[model samples]
Target: MYLWIITGVVLIVSFIFNKDKTIQGLKKAWKQLYGIGSLLVLVLICVAIALNFINEDLITQTLSGGNRYIGFLSAVVIGSIAMMPGFIAFPLAGILRQNNVPFMVVSAFTTTLMMVGILTFPFEKKYLGFKVALIRNFICFTICIVVALVTGLIYREIF
Candidate 1:
């Protein structure tokens, strides 16, 4: 609601200032919107299917009985290896939570999924400098570990 109102205000302002430029910009945006929307829809469908295929029961059982350290380790290892989309990762985390997976582990896993993309390392190194990519990943990995530990401690204290 707020966004629409703001957009309307912008459009009105733009029209008052420069109708021709605004019209041209809108035309270009419309041309690109369809392709972008279709790509997003395709990705969403793929992620939904992947989430459905993951074994919720197994995820729950494994997490419910695991030690804190083990869970943290698993998060790091799994996060490093798992190459799923964010949409799929969140659903997997939800399943793990329902199964009694520790909050710290889930936090770590989620962090690693977003922060440490080992699967994209080659492309990252090629586009950005290898050293820059490695350093960034190392920092992110360290932060994930710290976040997991801090979150685990906080949860332990609270509950």
Candidate 2:
């Protein structure tokens, strides 16, 4: 609601200054949206299916969710390997936590989901050779573990 209102105000202001430029900008934005609409739809569908099919209780029961180290490691592996957009991934992490999953596990999952990109390795490799891509992802994965551990420990202590 606020976004629409703010966007309306911006569009009105832009049109007042220069209608043609504003129109052209809107057209470009629309074109870009159209291009990614299909990809967005597919990603959302996959996310929904994954969340529904993968039982939260099973993960909690099997992955030693009560054991911080095991949960952390499991989170790191799952998050690193899963190919999810940040927009969707964060919400999923929250859902896991709400389902009584451990804080450390959710933290690790969220951290690696943002920092490491196992699925995007091909794209990264195309830009920066395979070696660099491999190294970068490895380093990022390690750093994510550290960050998640610290965040989880502090969060657990405070709350």
Candidate 3:
């Protein structure tokens, strides 16, 4: 892919200029990757299993029915409740889309998955204060809905 080529070029250039720094950076990156890799694999495995149990028709009916609004709202609620990093959320979004979920619902789900933190609210409130945490979550939730609507319009999912 283009991104891989670009990254390889940049990495080679970095190594040519400063091998030590490049090696250090790679080590740090590897450490982070190693830490997250296991969790990522587990999550993917769980998703695969869940997908087998879930009916694609049900998802299409519930999440792809843009005009209903129920599907959109359901996605938002599910997204808000679930917490995961962007790396994980993206692949999940792709799976959802492949399963016939519309762009609107996938965007809403991924946006809220990354932005809204209902499960982490207590920790956020402790560090950021209840008011700030509450406001941030509210704003993020509203923004995700707008994003979903715009995506729906773009995809002609909403009539």
Per lDDT, the best of the predicted structures is 3
Candidate 3, residues 89-117, lDDT tens digits: the string is 67766877876777888888778878897
Error of 2 at 76 (Å): 1.4
lDDT of each: 0.74, 0.73, 0.77
TM-score, prediction 3: 0.58
lDDT of 1 by residue, 10-63 (tens): 999999999999999899988777646655566566556654643455445555
- Model 1 steric clash total: 0
TM-score per model over all chains: 0.60, 0.62, 0.58
Q: Provide the lowest-lDDT 10-residue window in model 1.
A: 53-62
What's the number of clashes in each of the models?
A: 0, 0, 0
Clashing pairs in 2: none
Each candidate: RMSD: 5.7, 5.4, 7.1
Q: How accurate is candidate 2 locally (lDDT)?
A: 0.73
RMSD of 1: 5.7
Better of 2 and 3 by lDDT: 3
